[model samples]
Target chain A: MNWLAVKLPVLVTLGGIFAVLLIASLTVHLLQRRSPGKSYGELRSRVRSWWVMVGVFSLAMVLNRNISLVFFAFMSFLALKEYFSLIPTRRADRRVLFWAYLAIPLQYYWVAQAWYGMFIIFIPVYAFLFLPMRMVTIGETRDFLKAAGTIHWGLMTLVFSLSHLAFLLVLPGAEDKAAGGPGLVLFLVLLTESNDVAQYVWGKSLGRRKIIPKVSPNKTWAGFLGGVATTTALAVGLAPWLTPMDLEHAAMAGLLIGISGFVGDVVVSALKRDLGVKDSGALIPGHGGVLDRIDSLTYTAPLFFHFIRYLYF
Target chain B: MVRLLRFLFFAVLVRLVVLVVLGLNVRRREWLPKAGPALIAANHNSHLDTLVLMSLLPLEMLPRLRPVAAMDYFLGNRLLAWFALHIIGIIPLSRRPQRGSDPLAGCAEALERGDILLLFPEGSRGEPERLARFKTGIAHLTERFPQVPVTPVFLHGLGKALPKGEGLLVPFFCDVFVGEALHWEGDRAGFMAGLERATARLADEGRFPSWD
Candidate 1:
């Protein structure tokens, strides 16, 4: 119980975030009410959901040291479900999705168990061998290429890539270390989410040039650069409190998270383009289903986790 | 209600994202103009067809325009079930032969209330963009409500965006050509024959891409 009280710094940090979000929401409401144009009632609703999600994640950081991996694994399951629903698979694809569903809990279990060697290769190696073998036994030929591609891509993006975050949980650190290991997870999440907010704010305000006209027309270079700058500054500022990384390393981490997050967003945009339907499901208000919210994390998790593992683990 | 709207808003956001990514140009064919209590009869080619039709309509017309959808599909979930029935004001019909009910009553009620109704005479999804044989339900509707105008809309390109069994959205611009409203005259067979001819003519124009 004393250890819980000892975590006041982390608690206050999160409280500060809530206070900022509250002020921002009030500002958006006031501006919308006073402005001449119609209020973006939908956009405001989405921002409110973002506030809840950020608060929940921040509170988890204060509640326990080990909840990060569990929290992310749950997110991975939701994201994978959204991905598979949008991308149609054959009846034969059911066998593949079954393997995928099993892989979700197993991969997370590995994280909980802290089996580094097995967790690293569970999908790329073991499940890779196991899933294809299951598919081959089914002996269906129609759209086999598509079936394989869809299942493999689903696993790679949702399970294999996301598991890296869980793998980050067990990385070796000095026994007496205060700001490392679990703290790294907080650092990554903050940078990624902040980048999203910064990009949306800048894009809506000063966006003129489309970043990628074909895939995501609303994305602007102004937004991207603004996001990168803000996230980089945040990472640099928070590194000492959250990780063993120096200023240079923290900047690099932020750079990687921001760039990779943008790339992930573009990739999902292409996927949705391939699937004519928008949003995976309507579970979250203001945000699309679980998939739309975590699309950036699909790419960022693997990259960020590995960077930390290589440098510190 | 706000929560449901929030979910719908995100759904729209996802669609907008896909539309922007794929460059989907949603143009509505206003051949019949904004006539009151009209019936929109279009070929059922793909799932995206309904959304495209709804998107192409004027925003003001959304609350007034009711799309007739299958009961099994639209009524699968509770919230969507409510939205389909009450919010979007969709008219649900049962396709199962075992069940026989006055599906047209809902349509009739809406038309009597002076709201436009969109009905797919095919009653099911098909691969080709061509019109399938018209179900007797449409004929039944016309016979009951002789005053309501039936506008035939030919939409080209949505079949490519979301083909049956394919989940990914392909970017494509489509044109919807609205034909003159056809009224129910004395002869049932002749009225259907005329309806078939109009649809076939639009299909053969070949200016509209076939669902390949």
Candidate 2:
């Protein structure tokens, strides 16, 4: 509570986000009142979901630290579960999945304790080795390699990658000197998600050239470049208030998130394409699933965490 | 009272497990019958299927909702039988009724009273996440009351969450797809065929990733 009360910038940033969402809500409502057709239904759901998502996320960010950690861990669990559901898994390794899920809480536990040594290598090193051994105990070696690879890959993508966000909350300088850990997290997440939207809007309106048509047909060079520019400018604008970085460094961080956010989005598109599904699951109304919503965070969380750690921390 | 216990079991315990432990992604909920004289025939993968389906209906229907379970399996002892029959409100069907006794008499009576019967046509839990051959019991029950609408439901992921023999209940997200209801068109064979098709169609609608 003291952390939130002490930081004016953190409160201001959260308030600004709600204000922007309020405007978006107003815009969507006005359009719907004017048209009142089926076209606005999807827009209405999307806007409504945005309200809930932002509300939940901001509340978690400002609450107790343990609750915040648990929130992120639950998101990781959803992403991991979605990945498990999407991929074709060998039945022999059904029990092996328990270990995969067990890694989530343990990994987050390390983050909570700020034990970087264990957090850095727990999934990639320990779980990576333990999963195969656990599978071999079942004595089915036909598709052992594939099963092992898929499970570990999901853990890395969903659990290990996303845990970095929670870890960012406990960084050395995260407590007092600047906008605080929540600010850094909010900066990364806000920029990454906005970058995703910026790219989609840019590509939808003025996308003429597809960057990688095979992987993601919706993505275009215009969207990619435009998203990067917008995100970069936002990073520059937000850094001084929400982060410890100056304008130049914020722009650099923005460029990283903008480009990496697109990469992460298309990377998941490649996954869904290979698996031959439209979206991941039907958890959220307009959004496909937890995995669909956090795909960019999977990439940006780790990238931005390491970027800040390497530069300032 | 027994009714209070049953209400607490479903309204509190079962709802907690389903909503908290196993997040449900229920589809076509509007297709679910809001009233009685209906049958919800879901594919049996895990024991949780009965509880999950029962929780989907309105809590007020707890008095009228009954799950058709095996007599020998659910009622091996007096204490267990009491809990299953009263708390769970299960209409136990003796798989082997001695000397020409009408085993399905309880089910028919329950249906006659306009109770919503939760039945697993597959008879028992089979291989996890795999559809087993449905026994003729569903057809027999439906034939007795042709007007009772049987809603075919397909449940996914619960088998892996807690399967037939597995005691460990891992948290896995489950999906429930409710399909259009069917009625007895002709004989037991035709009605059975329709039930099979309805269930299989709902299963395909699940669109699970092809299991390796």
The best candidate by DockQ is 2
Residue-wise C-alpha lDDT for candidate 1, range A1-313, written one tens digit per residue: 4555124345555667788888979887887988849867887888788787887776655555457766777677666755654565564445456666788888888877878778888888888778777888988777777777777788889888877765655666622354444566667777787888888888899889999989988999999988888889888988888777778998999999888888888898888876765665555778867777777878888898878767766
- Model 2: per-residue lDDT, tens digit, B1-212? 77888889898899988987788889899899899989999899898999999999999988999999998999999999998989888999877778978878999998889899999988888888888888888888888888889899999988978888988887777999999988788699988888788878887776677554
lDDT of 2 by residue, A4-109 (tens): 5226787788889899999999998898788776478777788889899999988888876788899999889888988887788876777898889899999999
Chain A TM-score across all models, in listed order? 0.92, 0.97
Q: For model 2, how big is the iRMS in angstroms?
A: 1.8
Cα lDDT of model 1 by residue, B85-172, tens digit: 7655678877773545666777889888888888888788775455679776777788888887888877665565566677755434
- What pairs collide in candidate 2? none
lDDT of 1 at B41: 85
